[model samples]
Target: MLRGAYLILAGTVIALPLTPEGLADGPWWPAPAVTGTSSGERYHAVEPRLADIIERREKAWKAAAAQDYDRLQHRSARLNRLLDSAIGVLVEGEATRARRQIRDLEDDLRTQTGELARLRTALVNAPASGCADSGGSLVQDVKCALMPDARTSLQADIRAVERRVAELRAERTRLLSDLTGSLQALGIALPASDLEALLVLVSADRLIDTYAAYRSLAQVNAALIRAAEAADGDIEVLKRYYGFHVVLVEICLHLHEAFLEEIEGKWLPRLAVLRSEAEAAGQQARRLLAREDAPELRARLSANVDANGLSIQAADLYAEHLRDQARTATERWAGLYRRHQVALNTYRTVALQGDVLSVMRQSNRGFAELVRLELPPLRDFESTALRDAVAELSERLRLSKL
Candidate 1:
């Protein structure tokens, strides 16, 4: 559904070829000052009103930049603390902790497994029930007693036990996987005999596979942590990257709101006026055509009326297209802003809790990948105008270390 919506929006953009001036005439265009040319040569082309807003907000921008940097520093400090805690967990008998956890999970699994077996046995032995009528006169009340639905009850009980067993088994698998990975990460390998005893209920091949997968995941986790730590060390870089991203999101949001306001306040009113004019012109043209007498003059009048009608139709189409564009752009910007906000909030929370590993997990793989790929040099994101602006701003901030 989302893909189809985006395709439709892309088609709209491709189909409509409005001029920059036309777009700017309404609130559809982004603030010129915010998207000023890179060489600083085209700054004069910016609208006076937008330029004034940018100039007035210069101090605010600097303050925001500083605040962003401070926030980055705070996050870095928190991450450092988290890293220390993670290292502590890794160093302080992680294997022993994993073994204990695995043992507990195994015990729970055993209990659940036994419960499942008992439930299944009871289900098989449960009595079937049937309703029967005792022979009686047609007018007399029949004394019929229905047996309890023991089969249904037993089946329900079996299902409940099965679900519990499945949950316990899954938990046990997770615990074993974690323990295996932690031990492998620490370069500790249990002997085959020990593994067999520890995972007595599990199959040999499955244990081997789990051990291998755990080792691979442990390596990945270690590499991600190392990268995160390295990035944390360069607090200025992180600030610049994140600050630029935030600034872009802010600009997009501002532009979206401005476009919506323009649609409501300016465009809609213009459309309404155009609609009224078109209706009035159509009525006038119809009356004139009805009274026309001269051939050449009538033809000229008819052509003029047709041209007017066509102009109105074109105007209506253009206005509708603009409306569609505005709606699509608003949704796109909102979605982008939401994704960035979620990433930012999650980072802050997880960093505070010193759970960088949690952030690196598959559950947060998207965010982790973004951090790894985006929080680097500005040169990588020079494709689009907005990205180029972000790259330039990031470089400038990094140079000033502000």
Candidate 2:
């Protein structure tokens, strides 16, 4: 019946494309494909905003370089403040974001200082060919004559801003990961699997380290998030999920290891009980057939009656109905055996999840060993540093092994 149901479902699905008006004639069960929905769009939109801000910042910086000393001072101060705001805003309240912004700012500041130094040098080396409109003061004439130097310096400053803008653009490539981490830390509500989201974030925030792949971090976060979500936001959720998943995994492994146990412990014994009745039924039916000896009775015995004394010849004929008048225990048991086979498929699906965890656990152990090797020697390793590195991994291991 189940096979027939699946065949019907399959036929319906295959016929969908052939129906007039596309999906109009299809069954109501198939969900319509909604193409425009995408959660990642929001993240992509934010990237352009960051890029624009960086661009405007660079423009203002160039305009500042061309103005007088007083103007340059004021404009530079404003640029600094704008950069500070950009760091805070772009980070969206993440410590790692803050750190990255700080690095960018430091580079910008360094470039600014270099430009300032170059401008000062140009002013000092002003040519004897004085300013065309200067009245009397030598300094005034020199300033006027070196006006082009100031303009050159301003252009260079503009280029520096452009470079900063480029850096900001590169930064966005990893912004999604940083944002996800920050959101997770801040307890922001986002609709998705936490593990899936964290993996996306980790992939976005990938490091340059060759030994460590972004996937490793993603796996760790996925396990952590799954544990937390499974526990429904409880601190102990991690502990319980790990425990339950591990136990489930162990049970599956044991089952696989001793598959014969099912036959030895249950199936064969049940079959014995079923077989005894079938054998007795066969004897009775044979005796009945022998005594009758009529052609009709002999034909009935061969077609409808089994050698095992039962009226039904084929064992499967008793699967659907069994009147109280007849004893076809063995045939009934055969039905139970077939049903058990069908039920075991569900068990195997859950068992596969446990197998996934086992594989991940082994991989994690190997990676953790590599991380240990990469850490500083004992003299360089501070207690706090060592403690922090292992804290989360140790917690995970404890939970998984439970």
Per lDDT, the best of the predicted structures is 1
lDDT of 2 by residue, 125-200 (tens): 7554434445787888667555744445545566675676566555643554464454444333333343222221
**TM-score against truth, every candidate:** 0.33, 0.20
Over 4 Å off in model 1, which ranges?
A: 1-22, 25-244, 350-402
Model 1 lDDT tens row, 1-402 = 011111101001111111101122212212222222221222223223223333433344444232232221233444333322222222223444455555566557667777878877886887753321324534322222223366666676778878887887777667666766655543435543344232331122222322222222233333333444467545443332233223323333333443455455555566556556766887787788889898987897787677566555545554554466456556755564554455445445443455543343323222211111011011122124333333222222223310
User: Quick one: best TM-score, which candidate?
Assistant: 1
Scanning candidate 1 in windows of ten residues, the lowest lDDT window is: 7-16
**lDDT of each prediction vs. the true structure?**
0.40, 0.31
